[model samples]
Target: MTATDPAMTALAHSWSALSLLHGRIEGSVERALQTEHRLSAREYSLLDVLSRQHDGEGGHLQMRQVADSVVLSQSATTRLVTRLEDRGLLSRYLCPTDRRGIYTDVTDDGLRLLEEARPTHNTALRKALDQAATEPVLAPLVRAVHQLQGDIPRPDDRP
Candidate 1:
């Protein structure tokens, strides 16, 4: 297809449109979570990942992996982990095989908080999904966005 084709134009416009939509939805979720639970989106994201990560010992996410997943620099991830650790929400352990690598594990307190906040987070997500359902095009759009993410280079890796 030619560059001037309508499909190509639509695809270009879709990129920007989806970006705006994604940011707005994420912002809404962040605000509500911070207001009610005192958790930043980044912290929530880290916890979410750690809660699901498999470490052969327990749930934990390597600091670098979490940093990459959340698009935070290593220093930023370290600071975030420090704050959470101070709050008794997370702990970091040096990897046995790699002394320099740190793995952040959610504390039991963190797990408790996560369990407690599930309702709140679910509510916000449900509200977003409900809003999207009003348009009927949103769920499929979200799936397409996930697909697109696979093709897009990560931000930190991009020039």
Candidate 2:
């Protein structure tokens, strides 16, 4: 379909709205996290992800997997890891089975910071969505998000 086609235009508009929603949420959460815990959103996300690792087989994630989860390139993820490591918030180690593979884990300090930032992150997210829901174009998207999260009851749940 041509760029000017009605369907194409609608698709572009939907994409733009989604991007705007993401940006608004991230920006709000970032500011709150940074102010309250001195942690950036990405740093908090990485710490949260690493904090969930376990001793069970396949519990720890490879660098690539961590990068994918955080939506960053492997090199960038490594750099972030290094920075956190320097701050004593994270530690890296070579995989026991494969010396070639490395894994990162959150330190006690990281876990403490993550726990403290959790409420701020959640509050900021809720505030962002609440504000966005007041906008005519974003209200539906906000509703859709709540519906997906099961925050809003589905029609199927109605008697």
Per-model CA lDDT versus the true structure:
0.74, 0.90
Local error of candidate 1 at residue 106 (angstroms): 0.6
Q: How many residue pairs clash in each candidate?
A: 0, 0
State the lDDT of candidate 1 residue by residue for 82-148, as single tens digits: 9989999988878888798777778899998887766677667556645654564465665565476
Q: What is candidate 2's lDDT per residue for 1-159, written digit by digit as tens?
A: 676999989989999999999999999999999899888999989998999999899899988999999999999999999999999999988988999988888899888888888878878888899899999999999999998866633324565
Provide the TM-score for each candidate, comma-separated: 0.74, 0.91
Winner by TM-score = 2
What's the residue-level lDDT of 36 in candidate 1? 89
Which candidate gets the maximum lDDT versus the true structure?
A: 2
Model 2 ranges with Cα > 4 A deviation: 152-159
Could you tell me the TM-score of candidate 1?
A: 0.74
Sum up the clashes in candidate 1: 0
